[model samples]
Target: MFGLGPAAKSLREQEEQAITVPASKLLLRAVLNLVVAWFVFDEARGPMAWIVVQFKPSLATSVESSDTVNVVMNLLYYGPVALLIAWFFGRMGRWPLVWRRYGRPLVRRVVDAIGSRSGAGTPGKAPTGAKAQGEVVVDPWWAFRPLVGHGGLALLDQETAAGRVGDVDHQRLNRALECVRDYPDRLAALLDAVREHGAAACAHPSGTRDLPGRHSGRHDLLLRQVRLGSAEDVPKNPAAYRGVDLAIDPALLGTSLLAVGPAGTGKTRRLARPLAEALCLQALAGTAVVVVVGAADADLGPAEWYDVVVAPGDPASRYGLDLYGGARRLEEAVARLADALLPEELAPRAESARQALQQVVVPYTEAYGRPPGLRELALLLRGEPVAWDALREALRAGGGLTDHQYELAQRERMHGQVDDPGALLADRLSLLDRPALAASFNRTSERGGGERGGGRGAGRPGAELPLFAMHALDHPLRVRIAVPEHSHPEAARIIARLAVGQFLYAASTRQDRSLFAGLVVDDASAVIDVHSVRSLQRLRGAHAGAALLLRTLMDLPESLRTPLFGAVGGRMAFPGIAPWDGKLFAEAWGTVWVDERDVTRAPDTSGGIIKRSWRAVRTILAGERAQTESVTTRRVERRRWSPSDLAQVLPGGHAVLSLTAVDGTPVPPLLLDLQG
Candidate 1:
């Protein structure tokens, strides 16, 4: 899908076809020649002698009509062969390919003998070295993909025909491409180093280092920014930013972005789709690791851009989620899963829920060597006596348990007797254990693909389906996960929350901080909470980032409104949001010093006799009072974007976007024309 094969084939055919003479032109020439023949053989001079005498004085003699007939026949004898010559010219470009494919095989011995003496000359074949030297650069990125040999040169011709390549870049890229042609494997080694050591792979400059100036090792790529739209000339927008190009690159994304927009305000088209695509390309360049989470129907990007597509909502999905988020310690497992399952109102009981999950999870893992799946955990939490009895029996059968583990397992049998928090946690697990997601959460069924016996499928080898675990992203990989938002809103929320918690846990504990890891929660109403917001504050320092998309500011709790806005560096507000939501955004954007002009007109009071008499006369004549005008200008503090402006003044297909670079530089909010 990425290489230059199709373009090369077109170029090869174009080269073989030397000329393109349309059949209509040939047919017109034939008709005209036939008309000439008719006149030359006509009885009257109906123009035959007149037209012929213009070019040939012999026809003017009119001596011997048979002699004239002989001359006309001689001239038009080769007329049919003219079409033959045109056809040959069109097919001439294929001779080299024909010789290479067919002629070389029949007489290999003779061709080799001739080649041994001619040094480099061949009838239709170009020597490998000369072909490499003839390589013309089509795209600078072609060199990064290492498109070498005749295919590269052929694509150059194709690009010229398409008029997409300029002469300047063509010449400049050729100089860079020559270095790749000289040492093809060297780029492969350098790319390996980049994938291993992050931006430091390009720490030093070499004799032939050529790439975009905006790229460093941390977020290097053939292109720098992925354009989203442009800032328009509007009163709300700063004059300095009007008609300016707006884009988001990895450097800006490194600080994390928060996009707040309703469903159809081009959030998916303008923000999510572009960001996901950019991150996918960066992943291919071996510079970033990305995970995009969205609804099943959201058009974030195509599935092909991702290495693993974990569509938990789609029954035909080939990947399953690791319910425990790859946590090793038993406490870590209980804490992470409990955070995902418990309702927001029950957040105060988080510690109690953890204790309840630990009561069953520790014993289950002690017995089965892996954490409990959704079904097992749900049944255990339901306070079913039979399920607990069986689990306790299984834990006792395993004699490998230590005194503390066995003691904990024995204590599990009394879960119902105590005021267990399992009831609260079990109420939330009902969403995961639904019929639609029967084969989803546990991830052990064959339909769910082969899973290894590890803690929630983290780096589990020999699995047919991939597991969505951030701890396993030591290498560059792009993962896209889709949750069922419409049919199962609550379930989608639980999964979205789980994915975010998993990402935070992994990012906080990752050892190899080289790969710039990023997560995009397209609909984050279920994910962002008091806990996740706190974790997001540390993302900038961790060299990781996230893009949280919310439909409105009201999705966040009242207490979390300011913190959520403060935790992110890049912020956006799509058109048509509520005035209250815009108020929060206005407060977050803060105030700006504006030049306020005030013009007041007051009556000329206490004037001279002439002025008073004139004012009286003018008032009497015009039936109005006379006044003097006064103008005042001063710098005053005002909202950069007022609540009313953000709510109603923003035109359709426009959004207010602000940016923060990875190095902490800020750009004030400006109105972006999404269509532009």
Candidate 2:
């Protein structure tokens, strides 16, 4: 049901009816069976049969020994008939359970025999111990109603009966089932893909990584957990999270995460890569929407691994990004655009920038019945007198302005056209008008058709690919946008910011919060800003989260450090971080009370010279000094992780991590061995 949406409710009800029975009816069946056996015994006990029986009879009973023996013999003959009757009526729910227990062993034996004939079951094993036990095999019928709740296995039986899943496909399924027997999540994913797609689940996204040799980690995407690594068996970790399968999940990530590490740390390998993989699989399963923003050089996954891959410079991939994010209200679109383009330094006075955008956005949208693209918006915000003349003429031609509104628009042009805030916005907007990003922000200004993302939101007629509109986040869309940060640094920053702003704004307003919305940025130095941090903090109540990876906290101004710390519920410190950066982490994790012991020695006050000589002689001879001493034990406050410990003491290939679930469950800072 995680991804199944409205259909999940109906499916759930059907499964409940199919798999369960009422407790009262079950109790009644048990009582009735006993009564039936007693009446049968009364009929059978005519003293015509004999077997082993007590020679001494009970005083309470009137029946003789020969009659009791007759009952036992008759009961043996009638047992099969009575059991068949109960199988059909009294214990309908019991058969499926019985099949699960007995049928599995039977199937295992048959498969083993088949394998032995083929010379594949020749491996040696101990015959008398637990190692001799057979595998827990897949029972498709038994698993149908309880696990793999999606439409995966739902159609297999029908297809099998119709001869659609052939002998080869049946064997294929059996082998697949053997691989995923312990992972129900993977089983559902596989069967669902084969039903909808006719391909293996790992191969569905155009690349195969969920296979054992391909992906080197344990993933339970059904529970929304991907094991990052094992926590080190050390005292720094609380017993609950210590030396176990440490992980990142919706609860921990729902509040957002800030991973601070230098280049060699396993931040990408341990954190971002696994989370992205889970989100991609979830998208296929209809459980999540994940937008991954990384540099063109980053090896996140392959191109076919995503539903939409927006690589602007790559001609083979031709998707455009929506400028307005498909907002209905003019003000909402304007605000989102302004929030994205405004410089981080001017956040405190952002209202002015918003006003500047609102003025241009309202007039331009009124004239065209659609919001302006980045190029058009940049023209308006640039305070260009010629651009203003063109816009006013278009508005007058459309008759979208009233006498009072027209007067206000005129004054706005005359006064703030060449002002600071609007000029700043114009400069920021101009960054997107570059050549490297020619394929992006091509959302055409056409009403209702803006969502089509092809020509409606497309570029260059016949060759235009659909634009990755922000509204797509409303569904379980898996999108990967690779910004060419190395070649075009500033524009990359803007694109990263745009993706972040769009995700937060669109996710906040989603009517369906069932899908977990996630944003992953590989190198977040260019992305984090004041408003984003603030917006991310407020995301706790929404159905969204983000993972921002940075080399250090110094990239942000001093004012934003605490806010960045507060915005995210999960924090990770990789080895090789600077002591100054570690200081903030030390402060964030705070302190813990620990026992401290102190000892004080009393000086000898015995008879003068003689005692002093004796002590010196003993100390010199025995290498010890004896004295009366006192000890004191008390609890004292100490930093949970010191700055020095975070920076220098952490071993290579390890990090200190802390997490908080979406429901406010906290995990203390603990060390984890990434290589493990």
Candidate 3:
């Protein structure tokens, strides 16, 4: 009012405008802030977040700890006020949230605004020269038209180029290319052209036939010859070449081979090398290498049972063998196999035996007991004769006894009483006749050690099974005996028969192809019948290969004869003099045999001198014995074996295996012992 200048007038006008803000807009903003503050305060109400603060007491005040409550209450009162202010300004505007509801419309508005300023107009439309900002727009050419009509844009081309491979377009192309019917010649021509072009381009054949050194779409077959020990020391090696090594690819083979020979012939030693090689392979690849033992051979006292014999630095030992490790492995495999095969039906019987042994013999031994003889035990065990040698083996193996504990206990029992040796032995055997009692005795013997410092209660209650468990991948059964033990030799035969039979079964049962691991059964005349050898043809049909070892070719029936002779894969013959045996083997082994007349022709030839030389040679050869060979054969002329056949006669250091061979060839005795 004091000045009339233009500047004064403008200032008055600005103040009037500033005072004219509408009450409605203010109310709306206040309501919005209040609403947002309510939510924030409500979320933070339950727990007051604590903050540590140190303050100097009011200098004029004498502060008491009890006065701290008033200060804390004051701080809490300001918390809600600070929270409300922060919520109103810091985040209230965030509720506009076009992203949650009106996102598309908001985006459209912003885009349109930008387009208008840049002279580009809206998107998806043709550019309008400089006014359009050079941005090409896609026109809705089909707009204003009903659903069915064609559009001006080249849609098919765009769709095809951007579509997935082998899409509808690709399928259509394939159908056109493959369209063939109504013209045989055209199809043939097309095939011929394809063959010319595709064949020329291919690096390998697509045919199923195998072409060595070239890829023929056939899987490769590997033949692994696993040697247990150095072949150079074959004579000193027993169990050296147990068979082929476990290096055998699981993809190619399912079984291995074992060639056993007579005692002092290094049969067991020879098996060792291959067995070791197999173990190494199995360990590295997590593969399984299984070796089944013949019951007869197991019954004998193989060096494998005597850990001390195979220990390092033993003079008589051929090589330091890890007997304990080997036994453990073998036992583990057998036990696993048994778990799978021992049927529920047999469980009760086995358990009964176990309980009897535990309750009767174990407690008796714990109180007042002594080791009994095998004969008396046999009488007690249902009058069935128990193998004395087997009992000895059990003792030696520490089946239920410490290394020498059983022997010492027995000695003490027999200490002073010496009346009727036979009666005494019989009575002792009868006392142990109960299988349960024997089992218990074994347990007590193994654990008790005559109660003299030996902890009879220490060992686990279960019987130390004769056979061990197999690894997971191997067959659940390590070995199966199919003979009635009515005859000692027959029982031995049954044990030996399972070895090769198992191999053949494994290889022959392939789902698709034959496992190329060949089976070898040496000395095929001792236990097996000659006619059974021909039954091995089933194996051939199954695509598996086999080699039969024999001392005489004639030992096998004529029906089982093969033109390949022994040359099919592998063959070997020891020097022998049985004329018929020699002739038969000469044919089978692929070696030429000279008659006495032929040798006398030169210094290495003819007549009386030749005859004498031939006889001498035969003598040298006859000095050695033969063993049973396991072979696969068909069921023909199958004779039912009597119970007598189940009786087993095991040699001290060796076992004899008897089985029906594929061809009617007698099984050669298979003599095997544990290697040192």
Candidate 4:
């Protein structure tokens, strides 16, 4: 019999047996052929034998006599066939192998067709009327639905019952919904609730409400919200409950920020401090450079990451910024210094001072290979004989001037064109001659060198870094120019303007957009002008911005206020705002048509006999019988937020923000709470 041996003891034993006693190729082929032949013969025999059996019954009368010899032969032929069939069955049974290969694939195709028709398992495409993710779909009937019973709250419970909403507090949803339920007319409140809570909370049984946080988290930078408006407005809008979020991108800052409010209204703590802290974080990460200009008494908090503090004209200050440093050329450097020193009010003197400084700066820079310090420049501008001798000697030693040029410079010095403009220039220059101020401008050595050097060229204690050496777009630097305007108003303005000019020059020179640079003027009223406004407008492409703070727009010149208002992309008007300033914001925000209704009462005389009799019978109707009603309606245009409303209706911690949208449209004024 052809039968397999018993199973091997192990996999290794099986391998060994197969290697030692492999089956013959011809014998295995013959066995396979015999197995196939037996199967075919057995299948055909079943039908043939059935037919023979049917005929045998009919022809069986002579069966015993006829089949005696045939019976033996037939039995002999059928015996081997039956034995072969049994052997084949014992070795290998007939099974359909085709179904194993194709069954799963065929069933999958049918399932896929059914799924496509029934719209199952497709994630990318939405149903016919369904909204895409992040899109707001509002219901028209949302305003009419009650927030509690059969409205948003009920819908939330329904969704929760269906197991849709997840990981949210049901109690909080119900509370928030109930809070805003009465103000169904305020769609924004309902929408904001849905956004903060879940869609289920904003879903009414009849429809779903979708509200997006458009100005919320739409940018990388954000200002905290303390409150929305008044306590009464809380139930009317979600902005009051959750507070309104202020989103202003650092890039748009070039358009500038103007914050107007009273002194104690959280302008510094809520607005300036928070913004400065955000910039400080960026500076620590090496993405931005910040310069904060404020009064010496202003509290900017502890900024440990700040790289430099340039408090010029301060007795206790560590370093000073070179008024003429960081310019691309000596002319530009001289022009910036001249602008800072000569106030715009002294136009003629400013021109002469600019010319005189330029005349000396060209030769002095050529002679010494670096621009002169403020004191040195002042001495050259004086044009005295002794100063000329010192300058000629310095120039001769450096071999910067020819004989004719030296003689020409000497003649010009004698002619007095280089003389100081007046007492004002001299006084301004005197402030720069202070030891601390001089030492700050001296960059020749590490620490202003020694006492006789007046700390000039000697670096400060830990690491003496100059403010001009810090590039706004490339380095991580925090510069605070704290000059008390009360003690030295002129000097404070000079240093502030110098810092502003230096920042503008450095930012404009940037070729790549890798860093966000900002200049924050705590009291912008002292430094803002046409030049600064133009610089603000031009610095947008260089990734630089300015945040200007003021007590009021009245602090600015009447002519400059309009330009400043138009130039800034963001404006925040706090309470105690003046009516004139409020008007400015009102116009910027534009107007809308509001419908007004008027009702009047008059005497009525016309009536039928039955009506007169009824009126006479009822004593209560006697007064109403002579009464008539008349109604009048009209549409009137009004400012969105009138000046009176802004000055009076706005709460202490709240502000009205007139911000520019990312798409350049004006966003309707938003009432925001700084402390919320």
TM-score of every candidate: 0.63, 0.66, 0.25, 0.57
Off by over 4 Å in 3: 1-223, 227-263, 271-288, 294-490, 499-503, 510-568, 576-579, 589-676
What are the per-residue Cα lDDT tens digits for candidate 1 across 575-640? 988999989889989997765757799887777999899777555433347778786878899999
Give me the runs in candidate 4 sitting further than 4 Å from their true place: 1-243, 313-316, 347-349, 403-424, 444-467, 470-472, 599-631, 661-665
lDDT at 365, model 3: 30
* lDDT tens digits, residue span 169-237, model 3: 222222223444346675455344333432121111111111123211111121223422112211111
**TM-score, candidate number 1:** 0.63
Off by over 4 Å in 1: 1-223, 326-330, 400-402, 405-414, 417-419, 443-466, 600-629
lDDT of 1 at 102: 47
Q: Which residue pairs collide in model 2, if any?
A: 3-286, 251-662, 454-458
Q: Per TM-score, what order, best first?
A: 2, 1, 4, 3
Worst 10 residues of 1 by lDDT: 204-213
| Model 2 lDDT on a 0 to 1 scale | 0.69
Give lDDT per model, in order: 0.67, 0.69, 0.31, 0.59
Q: Report the C-alpha lDDT of model 2 over 112-134, residue by residue, as the tens digit.
A: 99978876532332133354258
Q: Indicate which candidate wins on lDDT.
A: 2
Which predicted model would earn the best TM-score? 2
What are the candidates' C-alpha RMSDs? 21.7, 20.2, 42.2, 33.4
Could you arrange the candidates by lDDT from highest to lowest? 2, 1, 4, 3
